[model samples]
Each structure stands twice: as structure tokens, then as C-alpha cells.
Target: MPVERTENRGADELHRYYEVYETIGSGGFAKVKLGRHIATGEKVAIKIMNKKDLGDDLPRVKVEIEAMKNLSHQHVCRLYQVIETSTQIFMVLEYCPGGELFDYIIAKDRLSEEETRVFFRQIVSAMAYVHSQGYAHRDLKPENLLIDEDHNLKLIDFGLCAKPKGGLGYELMTCCGSPAYAAPELIQGKAYIGSEADVWSMGVLLFALLCGYLPFDDDNCMVLYRKIMRGNYDNPRWLSPGSILILNQMMQVDPKRRLSVRQLLDHPWVVKDYNSPVEWHSRQPLGHIDEDSITEMAVNMKRSRESTTALVKEWRYDHTTATYLLLLSKKQRGKPVRLHPEPAVCEDSCSPLDILHFSEDEDAVIVGSLDLSSEYIDDCPWISVTQQGFRGQPDGLTNNKNVVCEIWDGYGFCCVFCSKKDRDQEQTSENKENIVVQEKEVEIFALPLPRTPASSKKNARHNKNVLTTPNQNANAINSKPNAVTPKGKKNLLVIQQMIERLNQTMCFHRSRSLDMAGTGDSGKKKRGGKMFGSLERGLDKVITMLTPSKRRGLRDGPRKIKAQYNVTLTSQTNPDQVLNQILSILPEKNVDFTQKGYTLKCQTCGDFGKVTMAFELEVCMLQRPEVVGVRRQRLKGDAWVYKHLVEDILSTSSI
Candidate 1:
């Protein structure tokens, strides 16, 4: 899914290198374009980041460059260059061969078990390398994972990598990240380890993939948060045993317990040899993990909170924007609770005024009494993150419901959403026989609410940055800033080579002009001035978003990028039979195709052929949809059984 660059033609002395191509995409913060390097005659993806516009968070750009250089793997998105000037920062990266995986999943109705495995294995392998290097990919989701021509995954967007040990204990007061996939603890206004956060997201991604919807979902965010905090979502029977196993571990309410990348790699779902369907068969019905586990996580959230607090405090600077201490407080008198603290930059706890117990370990915070009927917590929350710090919760506790909640905890503030339920609360609690299930204690602990001290001396607001370690009468619990430059072996050349290949392809049939910004003599460039249409210029842009939108629907016929191509489904074809027939003829080089809906291929010859069931589908806990939402199938409260789909892959290949 290479970006299609329309030429931005210009003339200048610097134009000695490849010509400037057209813009692929643009947002307020940055713009990306496709270019052909004159020296190498190669096509490349170039992203320009505006320095002043990134607000005060300059390190993110640096983090991205640093991460790309140090981390390299086949499945990992390749980084090519980091060109920095006093005014700008230019990042050159290897283009992802395919478009956003988000769009991909939407189009395919999700991949088969084997397809999911191929994707997971590649991504986890990339993550394993990333984690082993002593860093955490604070942000992980479908959007960041790019696919190449071979359907290989490449993890991109390292703007939030946290050095596990070496980080200058700079307190990161400003919580920044996507909320939908944030871990439960994060939503609870607690400190979280970077690795722990990543794993939580992995669970969300997996759930969405398997179920074709978010696991714990709500249009109203508060409702969503409540669901997550409960940590009591349902896993559908349709999910494979292997997938269920990984989802169980990755989405653990507690970060410490959340499966590590390495651990996940070893799980039956991730490991290549394990048969998912078979394992699900012999297993007994899965049970709901003790609801207490979520509350337990609330207790363990100390690490993320304390650590992030210490990091922020340690990095206190005199800059006005960095100063300001806002304490989170709850209104004692309102049904619709709202919080208005000293207003400053921070991660505000997402909970409303309703009092509730939360277990720190699982990062699961359960709150009761939300008016979910009208307004849902899932729709919004009381607090939100602002550049200055945390603002009042986004949505007050307006919706009324009587269930616990889940949250996305950030540096200081948090966002909450409802989790997918085992069944609506009515069904779960209505049955007298299920009393034992309700009796299980949720391991929530009482925490000291941060409040303004009425009597304690008010520390004068100095440079608002609170050092992690204490002052002169001190120990080093904080990090100081000299702005250490992270050094790493650069992998920019690989990106350059790939780009060059694209440039050659673009030029193969068309003579396209180039462009430059701020240069005096501008050159005139017209669309399709070159012979090859979008197909040609697009190859030059590696990191492109490919969707049916661009191809004018499947009716546009099959489209090919580089050597990569997609075939169409026709009315005459028997979907299952076609898939099976296609897989059967593989030359033992390109496929280990499965009828259950996946295929493995030999790279050299593209011939690994049709596969037989190494495993069968066994629902560990198959329940009615009303019972389970989209949680992994393993913990479905006991009941699951077995099937093979490899034959379809063989048949499909021939079509």
C-alpha cells in the first residue's frame, strides 16, 4: 500500500537529487510525500515534521528516530533516515507494502485463524525484539501495524517508546495516547509500566480481529469504561483455542500478570507448532476469572502512577507550560459528579464522583451507580487531558447503571469505557444459582484520595516540575535533563534501497517532474503527466493506505502493487470450494493451507500447498451471544468443542 505522490515539481540547486513528488497525506501537524532519490534513482517515503508545531513535546520526534534506528526486524517497519536541521526534522522510513491493517480487517471481515497467526507471530516477533532491547512501545494498535506485499506486518509509530531502565526519571505529567486500547490501570489514574500497557493493547487488537468488533464496546465512553473495569467481558465460542489463550494472558487486568511478548511468543496461539482447535477440545469449560482480579490490578497500579509521577517530578523545568500542579478532586454533593482541581497539566483519574473501590494490581477499577440508561460513561467521562494538564472530566456521571467500570489510566488523568459483558448484568445476577459467582470478592483496595491540605504549608510554586528524587537533602529518585542523545546503528539504507526500487518503477514508463518548497524557480507539473496511472506513482510511496475507496470498489477489477496483487470474488464461484481448490495445488513451496481458514506459504517458490487439520475447533465455553461479547473464547465461563477449514484455502488459491 505505497502512497501515491503527485509531483510537486520545482527547480533549485538542491534539486540535484531526485525530484520532489506529490503529497500523499497531510494533517495539521505534519505532511508526507513520495519522492524518487536522484542519486539512487529509487522511490522513497519521506515525512516532514514541523518542529514548532509539535507543541512542547519535542522528544517524541527524537524518540521515533531513536527507536527506528535501534529496532530492526523483517516484520518491523524499516526506518531509513532522520535528517534534523535547526528548523525541521525529516524522517525517511521504509514504506509498508500494504495499507492500514484497520482497513484490511474491515474489508476481509477478519482473517482466518491461520491468517491471524501469521500476523500475530510476525508482530510479536517484532515486539519481542523491541521489548528485549529494554524499551516499551507505549502505544500498540492495529493502526500502527503496517502490512507489506506479502501480508507481513510492520510495527510503526515509535513516538511513545519508554526506556525501561535508562529513562531520565523524567515525570511525564502530560498523558498522551489513544484511549480505546489503553490498559485498564491507565484509565484508573495510576502509574503503568510501558511493557504492561503494550500488552493490554494487544488484547484489544486481537479481540477486535476475531470478533469483527471491539471486545468491550460502547458508543458512550463511560459505559465502555465501566465494562473494562469490571474485567468481566465474555469470549465468544467462535474464537479459536489458540487465540483465546493469548487473549486471556495479554488482557490480564494486572500488568505484572499480563503476558510478556516473550511469554506470548511461547503461548499455544503464537507458537507455530501448536494446534489451536485440538487444545480447545480437551479443555473444560472456561470460567470467569475472579472479578477480584480487576480490583487486584487497581492495587498494583502503583508502579505506573508512582513511576510516571516520579518521572514528571524528576523532569520539572522552569518553563511555564511545565509548571502547575493540578490535584484531582471529586464533588461530594452531585449525582452528576464533576471535578475541578487546581487546573494544570496532568493525567486526571477518569472516575466520576461516585465512590467505589478499585484494585490496583489489575488496573481494574470498579465503580457502581452510573446512569447508563440516559447518558453512558462509555459516551464520555468527567475528566480529560489538556495541554496545560488535566481538565474537568469530559462527561459527568450522567448515565445511570449499577455496574463496576474499567478505565484508561494515563500519566495523571484517565479515560473510562464500558467492557463487553458476559451477558447483560440482568442475566448474570438474576439467576439464584449464580450467587456463588457474585460472592467472589473483587480485590479492590482503598486509596487515599489526593486532596488539598487545609493545614499543611503550601509549598511555593517554584519551577513546577517536581523532581522524582528529593532536594539537597536528597537521594536520586529523579532524572535530570542534559537531554541525552540516544545513539543507535542506523537502518536508513535499507529504506533507501527499497525507495530506489520504487523510483525505478515509477520512471519505467513515465517522465515525472519534481517540486521543492521555498525554492525560487518552481516547475510546472500536471497530473498523469506520466504514462502509468496511480499504479506507477503509488509504488514509489511505500507507506500508503490501500482501500477499496481508491480502487473504485472490487468492480474496478484486481489491482496490483509491485508484485503484490489481490484477486476478486465472483458470483460464479463457490466460496468454500474455490478456497479449498486453490490451496490444494500449492507446490509444497508456498502454502501450509488450512481449510479452517489459513494458509502457510514457502517463500522461495511461493508454493506451500494445502494443509490438513493439525488441530480442530473446540469451543471451550460456547455461550449464546447474549452471554459473551467479544472477549477471547477461553474464559467463556466453561463450554466449547472441534472443525477444519484448510481445504478452503487450497480451493481458493486456484480461483
Candidate 2:
């Protein structure tokens, strides 16, 4: 489907690069259309929002864009750029072909513990990164999480994101977010810290993921609020004791007591065995809400409604201007009603002592509650990356072969890169047909991971200045290895090239142990105090004894420092399928063991096999312990080249 071209020359001209297809998804006032990028032949999802329908939410739209533009996490939906016309705004976003997490949950009822843990870890990592940058995703739910073709999760919908002024952590006072996932502070309409509230929502999400239902759901709105406020919920028998412990801490009634993102990451249940230790950044203080921004939003809300006079009359100077602005915002979106008649003001005080009252029907539509009646797409087929190949065998090499790389192209799209050979042909067919090319021949390539989102103005300016083009992108592939300058932040093309070079650089060597070195004041104190050192050693031994896998794995010297890298496996292969392939080739005498960490470790025919069953990869690497070398197991006699994967993961021992 081509773009619905209009006479308004501005929009038509802007959309020329894209051939819009059928609406892939829709939201409150926006619709997401599948689009094809003419220049790159990349498939993208363009979210179009009409200026006329935005009403008072216009400021929010700007804020949402501002918030999303700066974020570049692998788990967060990428926003490429914004295109505005006289009447509509187009947000070019990454297209997630796997659809929503909610749909998967509905289909599976509940996920296995290992599967849930993989997704939960990713979400926690993303939240930790975003919180470190001083932004809060106020609305987090299953519906807001999209699964990419690789089954990797991407968080979307930043319409309720809160960024404090001065780039610090700030308390959000607004009664927003979905009721089912809302924290106690949000439900009670209290001013609460953003990250803490996020923790509560995550707890709710985890509970739902494990149990296939929300912990605090109720038909009556008031009953739900009461349940959330009291931290009232039952623990399902199926939930692991470790999981229950973490959830208990996250869903605390008091915001202050709730687990911070850092704590959540550090928790034993979250870390387990396979997940590497994350070095969390220092706490960034939240800034106070900008009065000017709040005031501008309030003004927009007033303009949105014609009869806000009665609503304004009920306001008293008792609350902060920010609070009043939020109240006005609620009036703009939901039911229309008049506030209670003016209360008699005490001569001694300027502020009123009583709270404003609403009429019976309108009272239910108060702060902290949003209408959960919106229609959402839950039937979209799982769009996997593994498609049928032309005939014979598919190209597996990085150079001079049939390669189809998925690019997140800022529009949440699974776009395929076009080789120079196909460029002319693609250009010729741009007008007559939609550029929905299923496959493109290209050199073997790795997509660059998105840059981390930063909140500082300096980072924002840097992002704005970078200009990327297909010609410049080609240079990344063809250019010889050199020390690239960071003067202009490295774009996706440059980063991808860097990874290709890295794959050629690494060689087999016994990685060294990086345990604590050179006795400092802390080390000296521990050594001098015999009882303290003994007590610590005793505790460590006790912990090891209790954990069977850790004890067994470490019995021989320290466990070999396993190499961890980031790679999105082809969509055609799932973990189970890959596991079966590896098992087929294993010797009959293979001493295979299945563990809680979704890992299969075996020793067979002089090969040490470590298979990780994850959404991203179906890794089955055989290590020859005698030579201290690693080799990937062949899948159906085809070389599964993983050399292009970037080694961004930190080793637990090193940290």
C-alpha cells in the first residue's frame, strides 16, 4: 500500500521516501502504518498523529518525541526521526514483526521460568539504563512491550515518560498509568519518585508474566485501588520462592521501601548464574518539575475545552501549581463535569483546607485512573525473520553472498539492507510498486547496536548534528581498519564495520583471572582481622554448598570464563529446534545435564558442549578443553558463523 497522498504538498513531499502500506497498528489518536524506505529499501513502521486530534495532548506529543529521540537501547523501540507537516506528525519508528508480548502471553497462558527470566533481565537492564539517564517510563504494561523477530523485547509508548528539569530524578505527582500496573503511590495520588513507581509496575508485570494474570485486578475500580494501596495479592504456588522474594520487595506499599532498579538488577534471583554482573552507574538525582512546562501544558488543556470555567472555579490555592495543572489535564481527557461550588475561604488563610468534589458519575474518572477501553491489536501473526530461501542453500558468508540483515531503522522496522548490485533495480521500481522486498543480496554484515540514550543537552546536540547516508554507510564496509574518531558520534554503519574488524582480531588464548588485586585499605583490613576473613570464607563455602550447579561447575579449578556476546540469531531457528540439532550430532556416551539457567552443558567425545537456549540465539559451542579452543557446532552441515557478533557483555569475574 502506497502512502495516502494528499494535496497538501508538504506531507506528500515528506512521504516521498516511503511507500506506506496498510495500518499495522493503532492507538488512541495515532495509527502506525507499515512503510518501505525508498533509498535503503528498509521496512519501517511510521506512526502518524493528526495535529487536530491531539488537542491538549500536543505538548505531551512533543515531550514523547523528545524523550524517545534520545533513547537508543536494544530493548527500547528506536525512533529514527520526526517529520511534521501543517496538520500531521510522522514518527518513523522501528517495526517489530514479532508483535506484542501480551499476544504471546495470551497464547501461551504463562511462560516457562527460564523464558520469563530472559525477558525480565532485559527489561531490568533497560530500566536501569533509562533511570541512570534520569527518565521514567510511567506507563509499563504487556501491551507496551513489542517482541522483535528474534523474540527480543522492545519497550514503546513514551507518551507518559517523565523527565525532570535539570536532569535529575524527580517525583511525579500526576495520577497516570494503567490502573492494573500502577504503583501504590500512583493509586493513592501521592507525589512519588519515578524509578520507585517503575519498580512497582515491573513487579506487577513479572507477576502477570509468571501467573498469566494481574496480581491486583478487580472489576470495581475502587476495589482495585484499595488492593494496590494495601499490597494485597496472593502468591501462586507455581511461582518460585526466589521470584516471590523479589516481587515482595518490588511491590511495597511505600515508595521509599520499593526496590530501586539497581537493587533489582543486583538481586540474586535476577543475577542467577548465566547473567553477567552489571556495573550500575551512580544515582542521578531527580530534578524538580519545570513550572514553565507544566503551565504551558495547562494552557493547552484550557484551550482544548470550551467550558472549563466551572472546572476552574473549583480550584483553590491549596495545592501546588503543578498539581492544579495535572488536575486540569485530567479534565481535558476524560468525562466533563463541574467541581463543587466555591467553599467559604477562611479570612485567616489564603489556601483552602478541603479537597474538591466531583459529581457522582464523573468521580470515577479521577486522577490515577485512565479508561482501559482502547482497542489494541492482539492477533498479528508472529513475523519471524527466518523466511524461505530461494533454492539450494542460503548464503552464509559475510561477503559476496545472499545476506538479509535486519535494521531497526529508527521506525521499529525489520528493514533489509540492499547491496550496491540491487540499488539501481530498487530505484527503478520505487514508483510502480511498494518496495517490500522480502530478501536482498548483500555482503555479510552485522547491524550496529543503537547508542545508549543520554539526557544531557550536549548528547542531544551531538545526536542532532550527525547525518548518515547510504554512500557514507558503504565506506564503513569498504574502508580499511583504522582508529575512527568520535568527534562526530559513530553512526550505525561505522559501528557495524568496527565489529567486523574485531571478529578478525580475536584469537584463542586462555583468558586470565581478574580477581581483586593488590591489597588496599579494604583488603588489608580484611586480612588483618582473622575472624572477619574466616567468617567471610565460611559464608562463601556455605553458599557454594547450597547451590548444586555452582558447586559442581566450580569443583574443578574456577569455571572457565565463558565468553558472552550480543547476537540476534536468525528467526528461522528457535532454542528448542537448535537444541535438537546439537543433540542429534552428539556422541551416544555424552554426559549431558540440564540446569535451571536454561543451559545445557555436556562432555562428550572429547568435546565440552555449552548450549544456551535464549530468544536471541540457539548457541551450541564445543570447546576442546585440551587445546583451550572453542568451535561452533555445525547446524545441518552449515557453518553458523557468529564472528560478526559484538562483545559488549561484561564478564562476571572481570567486574
Please, what is the TM-score per model?
0.41, 0.44
lDDT of each: 0.40, 0.48
* Model 1 collision count: 156
lDDT of 2 by residue, 1-655 (tens): 2223232333443333344444545444666766544333345677777877778998888888887756656678766546765567877777777677865665566887788888898888778877877899988887789887568888988889888874546666887888888888887778888888889999999988898778987757799899988998999999899988989999999877888888877688887866665544322111223333344434645543223333333422112221333333234335232221221222221211111112211211111001111111111111111111001112333243322333221222222333433332322333122112335331222212221112123323522322122233334333433322222122223334423332221111001001212434564333233222222222222222222222232122111222212212222223445444444543332333333222233322223443321111124222222211121211111011111111111111111
Model 1 residue runs over 4 Å out of place are 1-15, 166-174, 272-655
Best by TM-score: 2
Q: Write the per-residue lDDT of candidate 1 for residues 223-270, one digit (tens) a residue.
A: 877777666678888887767777887888877777876577667666
